[model samples]
Target: MIISVDHGNKSIKTPHLLFTSGLVESENQPGIKTDCIFWDGKYYSLTEKRISYLRDKTEDDRFFVLTLFAIAKELEYAGIKEPDDTVDVTLLIGLPPAHYGQLHARFEQYFLRKREVVDFEYNGRYYSIRIGKVVSYTQALAAAVTRFGELKKHASSYIIDIGGYTVDVLKLRYGKPDLAVVESFEQGVITLYNSIFSQCNSQYALHLEDCDIDEVIKGEPTILPGEVQILIRKMASQFLTEFCNFLGERSIDLKVSKCVFAGGGSLLLRQIIERSDKVGFPIFIEDIHANAVGYDLLYKSEVAAHGGQ
Candidate 1:
């Protein structure tokens, strides 16, 4: 079985596939809530009804690690069974490039030390089990592989992952990430929303709620002052500018056979790139589960490489 967990700023997604008997099953999205709670040396996932409890408990505290726990809880909640005993499982997760240095080390320590299959209690019920080793969250690289498989011929490509909270631009030279050209930026949809909200409140007597912002992105054509649109354009422009600058600093040409966009925020940002005449080549956005599918490919490759059963 290969599982890929996509922990985004807005939601948590787990897509998994079981590989056995010489057949590959299509990945299924296991419906899972994104909230979790850690209490008394045991982790408990928060049901939709219990989400109110966490607000009072974890004010201003980091709950990023709970993202992984949320994935485990979801798997069990969906009744996805694992093999008996300790089965070798490879977990593929995605991490923000900037936090790779600090967060990666902490994740490794937390998962490797504790191998217990403790109950992920949620709403007074045991929801899931946390198993397997803490594997690398290399979904960005996996996304490249996923996109490459769809291309008819091999060519260099640039993958701009405009995720919920961050944007990662990576160069795929001959279908693999050129580590030297990879860069992460903090400007993402969440930050964009904050900027729009700030500008709206300052200029007009308007306070934008979360759903209102989403509604705008969903093609509602928000009735904002023209200045707000300019601010948004500027923010997006700066992000792409920094990405281009990073490529320039690395002496990497902007030439690519195709520029692929993957992530939840891609739909909103698609027009931003479409309007830019300087951005060469056709831009393509992969399906929402592109990373999950790519992670499945990587998981199978790793298992084959290691000679797993």
Candidate 2:
């Protein structure tokens, strides 16, 4: 079976499952645990016992646990008998454009052709699977390929991926990643939310969780009051203003290539970008799923191109 996993700083996204990128350390495993995994010198909780994971999870062994958990959850959802099944698996993941080259070999060494036992319970079901091969792609490029598919007519593109933690821009030339202009901006959607959360907590004494803030960002009425809503919008405006200033300082040549906006964070900034005449009508695709969808598509294409080699 082939699977793709994206360990975004704020969330873990796969073609099958999406969960908060949070892990908790827990001991006291006396009487048989239900949904925990022991891997690479750490005990991790698969379900509720989580603190937000913000660092480079891919560099450590937690990536495997997350992948196994995603596969197990997907199998449970698919009604497959998964306990003790040593299924062959091909794992695909992505990285930022700037780090893709330096980390490519490291990630490949860390994940490729690995056989490890993953025992976990997902959705009231038990599962065990042996991991097989692992592969990776550049995040922004994968998103662009996913957006354009095989029929992409453009020869070059500037992929502006506004993700949860970082906004990465990759310059693609002649249908390949041009690493020279790859840039990563610290401003992202989480920055906007974090600003709002901190402001609300300081001003209104409202301690809202990340999930609640996400709901509000999606235009849901969270009983958070119109006053808070106004305040958050103000914060968003300031964030946009600052982002615009950052863009101005960078002096990106928008005319050099077609701009494609992608990632979950893109949805919030799409209109702002459209309104500003700076970006030249940036194209927006399936923001949240573009990278994973692209990874899946790439996996299929690779398999077909290689004749399942």
Candidate 3:
């Protein structure tokens, strides 16, 4: 089966599941009760190793390793077992537009022909898979295709994909992507999440967990103090304000006839941005996994473009 993964700084998302992108490589094996992948005498699972840029992220080998992990989980999600402990499959993934040019070839070449063999345990089950053809795309543009399908191709538009650790903007004029005006920045949900994390930490001296952060972002009921609740609302307001300020100045929104805000951040930003009088409401921002969906939807076209059936 073909698999697509959007490896964001905060999460690794497959079609059916969202795995925390907080992987840590540990020397000791995890307890039997723990859910983890044991490979090469080390255990790998969600930890606090959140990273956005290449400088701070793991090396290329670790990327390949994580890709293997994703593949294993992908197969499990499909309810398939690896005969001979090796299953061949095609893979599609994306990179930030800013990093696309520099990193695309490297990632493409990483798993070109090798029948990658991986043995790992997920949910206490042992599984293995042989990695096969891997293709890559610019995450933002891939998303733009789905968010703005061919039916609306000719419309001038601005796409702002607010990811976990990066904000990728693409300006489209007359149906063609305007790379010259495209921009990506470090500002993302993690920025706001981290700020809120620190604010609660300093104000209450309480180290809240990721679940708590998730609740705060999801607007779920929480036991946090009323003052902190006010602070949470304030932080959300500031995030959207800064987001609008950045999008207006950074993206070519003034020149476009349409605007779109995609990615997980869209969910949180939508409510606040809509209530604001300054920013224009977007027409499309539905699926949080639009990139993966787009990749799957456009797979045949892409393969055809590459001279395949």
Candidate 4:
């Protein structure tokens, strides 16, 4: 079995592909809220009722710990088992690129040291085993796979992934990522939300909890002020412009084929790209779970290449 785990700022998404004998079965574990409680190097998830209690407590760092615990519990619930009887299981997790170099060792230690387990029944067999070992890779790996697959039909392409907290831009030359042309920006949908809330306090007083910005943007202007909408559009435009300029300086031809967009923030930012005339080629948006799905596919391919049982 190959599992691709994406731990996002807002939620954790895990998608798995089980390769048994000559067959492949795929399943997605629902996203879990990013809330947990940390105790003695172990984390536990808080129940919905516990969240309500924490809202009223306001204790120092209590919310942070509880949030971590909540996430850990959810991972346990997602069929991760303890290694009661030693079995070979390889797990690969995706991490933010920036953290790859800095937190690699620490992350490995945490996963290996942590005794958490995921419990589930498979093919009439019950198993309880700790993740044998957890491996971590940059989100770029997943992003690269997604871009390559989406642009494989084209000769060359550029990928722009506007995620929750960052925007990753890369150029693919013949289905392979040209790292020299890849760039990332901290400004994303969250930045837009903060900007809107900062500018129009009364008109756009809603918080992330009260509204789903992605859903609201899909329909007509219902909650956000027109002024805020304008700002968001401008921000999106600027991001794309910067990305294009970076590509141009690197001598990457935007006219090669098309530009592909993915990530949670892409839905809202697609309009800005579609309306822009300064861009040279057409823009396309991949599915919201593109990264997760791509990673799952990549993991499966890797196992097959190794001739795993």
What is the C-alpha lDDT profile of model 4 across 117-215, one tens digit per residue? 544333223344355665666664476575565567666676767765666666677767766656666755666555555545555664443133453
Candidates ranked by TM-score, best first? Answer: 3, 2, 1, 4
What is the RMSD, in Å, between candidate 4 and the native fold over all Cα?
A: 9.4
Higher-lDDT candidate among 1 and 4? 1
Ranking of models by lDDT: 3, 2, 1, 4
Candidate 1, poorest ten consecutive residues by summed lDDT: 17-26
* Model 3: colliding residue pairs: 22-47
**lDDT tens digits, residue span 73-168, model 2:** 656567676455566667788888777777776776666535665555443455566566777888877888875653266677778888787888
Q: Report the C-alpha lDDT of model 1 over 202-238, residue by residue, as the tens digit.
A: 8776887655655544446777656655655676666
Pairs of residues clashing in candidate 1: 93-137
Query: What is the Cα-based TM-score of model 4?
Result: 0.64
lDDT of 3 by residue, 147-234 (tens): 5554265556777788887888877766468767677788888888889889899988877665666566567889877777777778
Each candidate: RMSD: 8.6, 3.7, 3.0, 9.4
Over the full model, what C-alpha lDDT does candidate 4 score relative to the true structure?
0.52
The best candidate by lDDT is: 3
Local distance difference test values of all predictions, in order: 0.55, 0.69, 0.70, 0.52
Clashes of 1: 1
